[model samples]
Target chain A: MITFMQISKRYGTIRAVDDVSLVVQPGELLALVGPNGAGKTTLLRLLLGLIAPSGGTASVAGYDVQHNGAAARRQLGYLPQRAVLYGNLSVAENLAFLAALHALPLQRVADVIALMQLDAVAQRPARTLSGGTAQRLGLAQALLADPPALVLDEPTVSLDPQSVASFKQLLRTLQGRGKTILLSSHILGDVQELADRVAILHAGRLIAIDSIPALAQRCSLPEQIHVVLAAVSGDEPELLARAGAEAHLDGDTLQVQVPLARKPAVIQALLHAGLPIRDLRSSSPSLEAIFMHLVGQAQH
Target chain B: MFRHTIIIARRELTEAVRSRWVLLCGGLFALLALALAFVGMRSVGLNGVAGFSRTAIALLNLVLYLVPLLALLLSISSMAAEREEGALEVLLAQPIARRTVVFGKWMGLAAALAIALCGGFGSAGLVIAVAGGDTSAGDYLLLVVRSFGLGLAFISLGLWLACSSSSRLRALTWGLLLWFSSVLLYDLLVVGATALFGGSALMTMLGLLLMANPVDLVRVAALIQLGGADSFGLTAQALIGFLRGLRGSALLVLALLAWIIVPLFGAVRAFGRRDFTA
Candidate 1:
């Protein structure tokens, strides 16, 4: 539903987005993860046609963003990072204006307001709402037109935990409805929980793009083996350490970071040690670890 | 495209109305018009100044000083504030063209200012008519309409400045300087120039100079219509002689229309070309 083809945006000497190409297929929930100055926002703005690309092209629903910006944007529901609304207008009024801009029926405003659960303060001025409420209002406006594609830039940045959970739930529902979503976020947990695929951008370039497990496999990060012993044993941590694992003893629990290929051998070694095992669990590398490993590798 | 533009325009208008900008500006104009009309009537001993032409002429000076300045400040501040508050970015992300955004804002603001001008001066004109005064309703209506044109010209200039400026502070600085040059300093500079260099070229230079400033163009247009050109001293008489009668008025109207079109076009162009990243 969305594609960025060799897109590059430059500000004099600074290349904000450098020859990046990405695509979000129909009903695919793609999360864009990067640190600050990673050009995630720039990439999204390029697709929105808010800023022209220095090179290459971007398209939404097969319409070139530069030449057919209005048509391209018609297929997109954008939630900006700041999500600022007109302070003087009420929540409902703001959404209604957006609906009118999209040429949607006024009924969409009411529907979105209800969907975002903004009924409690629908008539209140946007400026008076809390950060979470305002974020919800921003989401409501984006969802007002019922566009098939969504571009959400850090949609949950300012939300409380409860609101973030609800927002994630909303994203899941939208995904269930077959909306192609491209969301840029700093929260790896949210991305891990919702995204079907993750695109890692580092220093204006997309370094990696794949599913979490695939990325982990490609990065070859170590998996963590956690063992809770029934009793603490002297020299047990030493024995695990000698087996080429980064082993640490925390009270009665033994935690070891080992390569994925050596997990079976490590488990056999721990079993032959004759330690009473209260609990044994082997966990794959987390998305955060994979992200850090990827970004760290790119830095080197 | 037209629908999107109108929708954005309607939003701008609704925001102005909800924020009481319309009421505030309307009330201010009405109060000033009433006060000026009553004062002019008293000064003319209730005889000559009771007519609509005379009151409109009296209000003309006020409009020249107030309308352009108010329009510049209002339009510039609104644009600057929207841009600073990031509301403009939100609007631009919509499925609308950049030109539509600029034109919509201009139309909405122009409409609001028109309502205020009519309500304010229109009510004052009605008061003079109700009091059995010798009022030329047509002439009075013409004055109000021209004042609206003047407002639109300034609004367009203001939007041009707002669109080009990088920040609210910069927009305000440029707006104030433009307002000062056109409203307060343009006449002084013209008078000084004509006095220092008195020749056949002076009339042509003066005509071009007047056209350069929409405020002066509006003032000259309104004064000539009110038949008060002679009161503005030798320059007005000289201008009237050089350009002839009807042609001069038409030229001033044309100049005013250009003032509205050229700057608005520049604004639309600037808005369409600039990046909204910041």
Candidate 2:
């Protein structure tokens, strides 16, 4: 449960977040996908009350970010873009200090340690930890309070594949527990697999907000048809082009773009022309495709 | 607010005790204290100053120089390092008020300075006891009380220095300079100017210049404790006697209070408007 009413934050002459109003329902995983400097982190910080917005208002769980910041922040768990932890403190000690700050019970420290899989190195000082381990520690501290909402800013960037996968699994677990998660990331696959709903941002503005499937359709990219052929002669390319279409011929495989309404006619024409069609399938754009298309359109 | 402050204060004190640098520095101050006591006791026995004026003045100068130096080195970096490490944001994002964090940090640092100077003076007092020196219990108690006030003043000044500067290195530099100028250099300039301008001008300027350093008030407290009030002529002795009374303790208390309050007020004002993320 988060709301932004015409929230905009400016630094000097540039607006980092501009006139963006959106709501996140409780118990939803919302992915904020944007290019670099897209105001994703700014919007999150505004909600967390880490920075005061220059105009309008932001509220977390119905508490005004400016007026009731302390109370509002008590219900927020935030992992910032740069999680600077005390290098000399043990993983357990770091979590304990944060848990104490949140007034969490002392036992919750061990619970977070177990949840973050930090039990093995719980006594090890954080300076000796690997980057992924440190990232997990930061996440553990954020979640130690068991807050109602989580704002994780770029939690997956620079993490190894296994770490990324583990992190995704953790997010899914949190989502299952009915915690509202707003994850800002550049990794499309993670967002595609983990996000229940996605909000796309471009240069300090919200460009699109929808489910992944709906987002693909809104991108207006033609549907792609993957057709595997037994052979592609030189004249077959010209024939496909004369049919008001473009085709790429790759060693007995033809990937073509066709209108949804014209798919049947194109397939029939290919079949009648004596081309051996092994497979034909229509596919919507990938998340990457949709992201680039939407971001590109917003820039112009 | 008080609960949050206590929480932060406990955290700070725990962290400070764990730092090897603090432990080593505290050890060094203890060594310095012992050395000063040994040297002052021997010199006082030979010089035959039954009034103990010279011995008292020497001890006062040594405490003034060391207490503030150690306090500055220790406390000036408390918040700057937290800010640099981004831990300040994490701490602030909790339910704690900004002023609570500031006051808590100041108290934690004050506790650290207290333990440090008390350890140093406590060792000095022990050396005197073991050596069977010509000192009263009141002498040791007075020294401890005076040093406590001095340490509090210096630590508060350190907090102020840290608040005014954005960088740790700069805070350290400014804090050390403030201590050096006020403790050693300021009096040296007064002595030199008095020599150049002769007695009347020196007399005219000394009172205002002396007030420039809160450590001077501490020195007065120490001088009165050691029975050295009469050695510095009627004006200096009268000033010492005046500062030694209930009124004097009140002034000393006010100075220490300002040391803690003024800079803390500035820090809170600056911090509330500061862009902590930057």
Candidate 3:
């Protein structure tokens, strides 16, 4: 339910977000992953209408952000990279104020407070909250209106492991409830686990956007087959090449890089070639590996 | 829109109150006013203008000097910190108009500053009344109003600076420089102009100069209202002679208001168009 069409933002000579277009369908969890200065935050801000685009338009549920920003933002719940509440105001007060912005009832604030499990510190000033609690307070504010869409920028940056796990669970629940979630993050594991699709940005451009397997396949990334052979073999590379694979030999083991579809054939070919495979293990590339390959390729 | 503005405004005011920003500034102002009242009585024994008029006159320069700096630093630092710390980004991401955020912040800050100024001066006014000195409540109230007007003007300027600057330090630096020029350099320039010019031309030039700075404008207005026009220097007296009537009072209020409204309008525009990206 979120859309950006040819949206570009320029800071003098620098193109912060360059002619980028994206869409987040309802109930889908899309993760934006990028390095520093990769335009993730800029894209989010442009969609929030905190900054006007130099060219093109962004909309939420078909309401143009620039022209009807209030209405558009009404459908969005945004948690910034650094979720700052008024330091001097208590957690409940902060959530209540945000709720009032959407004309939501005080009951909504209480609901989010419970939803985020901030009941203990409800009366404490946000300045006194720990990083995880503070982040939870920020999440509480974002969820105050029960919005159908959430745009979170780096929501798990500094959270403790427990909090991060809880946050991931919450996202899953929200996704099940059909809330459109578009989160920007640097953590590959979270993206791998939570995202339905990943959008990789590199130097102000969308470099790749697809499911992990789809992206890995499109990039032709090599999965691995590790074989602890009975002894060191000199002809392993040539033998693996015959089976449409590449092999790197180290002592008594061979690491063969091949697609998952060809893994069984390669292993069978190794057997046919009279190579001794004492033990074998197969693995696929992680999201991080895929991310690096994509970003590294874009840089080239 | 109004509802959202009020909600934002209330949150800001709550922050100000909870932070003890109100208590600290209000207590300081009251202490300063009481000290001024006590000193003015002793000083008045020699000059023959007793009680509230003397205290009001003594408080005029103090208000013009201190209030603008206080308001500028408070509003500028508050706005700058909010933006620098990412609070503004969060707030603006909500379903509220940009202009509403700016206006709401300005109003909340304005109310807090007014409370402090009035509470401070009111306590001192009470002391003077209880002491059986000559008391003119109108004169003292007039001084408070002038102080608030001058402060409102500076607060507007501070918000504009905060909206336009890139960092908190940069915004605060701009705030301090603006306060210095308006509170210090502008007066010196006017004095130099008076020395360089002559006759009827000098009178018009000095009048414009007095109106050019909010501090000087409030000073002239206070001097005229307290019936102490003859007490100032020739430049101030000349402007006083030109602006000592109902029309002049209206002009002063209107000009002071323009000082307040224009910068606030600029702040709203600047904030509305600004990017919240670091």
Candidate 4:
């Protein structure tokens, strides 16, 4: 539902967003991940028409952002990074104002407030809310119009762990409801948990875009196998190494790093060695590891 | 578009109400107006400043100074604060047009200032009427309306400065400079210019120069309407004569209207073009 065609934004000599084209399909959750100054926010602003792209075009649904900003924006619900609301106004008042802008009925305000679990603090001023509650209020406003597409920029930046979990749950619910979501975040775990596909941006360019597992597969990074031994063995390391796996001894445990396809064979060889395997666990590469590896490779 | 504009305008008004800006400004105006009326009556001694024309004339100088200053500071700070507080970014991301945001803010702020001016002066007028003063209610109302126009002109100028400046401090600095230049320096410059160069051509130039500053236009308009033009010196008399009757008054009103529109147009244009990143 959202598309960027060769979109580029430059501020003087600095290119904030380079020539990048991306699409968030309907009912798809696309997470945009990048370090500081990777132009993620700039790209979002280009799509929102808050800034004119130095080159190319961005569109929401079918309307060009620059030429038809109002119509384009009508199809979008945006949650900005550090989502600042009117502090002096109550939560309900803030939502009511935004709802009025969209010409939504007053009842929609109550619905979103309840949906975001902000009904208890609806009458309180926004400034008094905690970071997590504030984030929920931000989500409430974005969900106010129930628009088909959502563009969330760091939607859970300041939230605590529990709040982040709840936020991920909300994203999952929205995904189930078939909403097109384009979110940019520094938290890769949240992105991995929620995004159907990940777009990795580095130095103003989109370097990679794929599902977490797909990206891991493409990177060919090793999965880790943790083997906790009942007792230490001098031959355990050699046995794991002979299986075409990198092995290290950590106290009474053997840690093996092998390709995903070779993991079964490596574990079978350890079992054949009769080392008395107390426990064996294999973990796929995390999004963080993949992201760091990708970003690290780009730096090189 | 109109609906969107009204939505924004309504929000701005609600902010004014919640902040009690309307109450504070209205109360300030009312207190100042009553004090000025009482002081004028004392100075007149036995003649009693009971007449609307005299009281309005007394209030004119105060309104000319206070309205533009208050309007400038209020508007400049409001826009600057919105940007600093990050509310402008949220507002811009809404589906409404940029022009609608500018126009809606102008409409809302102008209404708040109008309410303040009316409530303040209206209460003073009531005091005069109740105290057995012979003031004309219509004349007093006209003064209030003229003051409202003056407030709008300055508010637009302030918004233009707010839109164009990169930071709040810069906008505020420019706002104060504009206020000082127009309110205080403009008249002095006019007097100095006429004193240095005296000629019929200079008089014509001076007439045009007066129209260039909204404050001057408002001041001249109020003076002429209150029939106190003679007190402002021969140049004022000559300029008033050159403007000549209904045509001059209409031209002054038009000039004030242009002051409101031109800066507002500039603000909207600047707002529409600039990136909200800062």
* Pairs of residues at least 3 apart in sequence or in different chains that clash in candidate 3: none
Could you tell me the lDDT of residue B223 within candidate 1?
69
State each model's C-alpha RMSD to the native: 2.1, 3.6, 3.0, 1.8
Interface RMSD of each: 1.3, 2.0, 1.0, 1.2
Give Cα distance to truth, residue B251, candidate 1, Å: 1.5
Give the poorly placed runs of model 1, Cα more than 4 Å off: B44-50, B132-134, B232-235, B242-244
Q: Report iRMS (Å) of candidate 4.
A: 1.2
Supply every candidate's count of residue pairs whose N, Cα or C atoms clash at under 3 angstroms.
Answer: 0, 0, 0, 1
Q: In candidate 1, what are the lDDT values of residues B120-234, reduced to their tens digit?
A: 8777777778774655687778888988999999999999999999888998899899988888988899988788766567777888888898888877776666777766657
B1-278: candidate 3 lDDT, tens digit per residue: 88877887788788888788888888888788778777765764653234777678777887888999999988988899888788988988888888998899998999889888878888777777877455567888888888999989999999999999988899989988998998889988987897899887888888788778999888878877777677677756766776886787788899999999999999998998787776
- Better candidate by DockQ, 1 or 4: 1
lDDT (10s digit) by residue, model 2, range A1-300: 888899998989998989998888999989999988899988887886667899989988999988998888887887865564666678888887787777788799999899889999999988788878888988987899899898888988868999988988888899999999888998998999999889999889899999887887666666677778766676777777666556787777777776555667777777778877788887876788889888888878
Model 3: fraction of the reference interface contacts it also forms:
0.88
Question: Weakest 10 consecutive residues, lDDT, candidate 2 chain A?
Answer: A80-89
Could you give candidate 4's per-residue lDDT for residues A1-300 as a string of tens digits?
899999998889998899999889999999999999998899888988888999999998899999999889888888887675788899999999999888889999988888888989999999899989988888888889888999999988888989988888889999999999999999988887888999999989888989998999999999998999888956777878889999999998888899988888987898888887789898889999999999998888
Give one digit per residue, the lDDT tens place, for model 2 in B89-163: 667777667788778887887777667666665665566555645465466566666777777777777777776
Instruction: Estimate candidate 3's alpha-carbon lDDT, on a 0 to 1 scale.
Output: 0.87
Q: Quality of candidate 4's docking, in CAPRI categories?
A: medium
* Residue B77 accuracy (lDDT) in model 4: 82
Chain B TM-score, model 4, reads 0.95
What order do candidates take by DockQ, descending?
1, 3, 4, 2
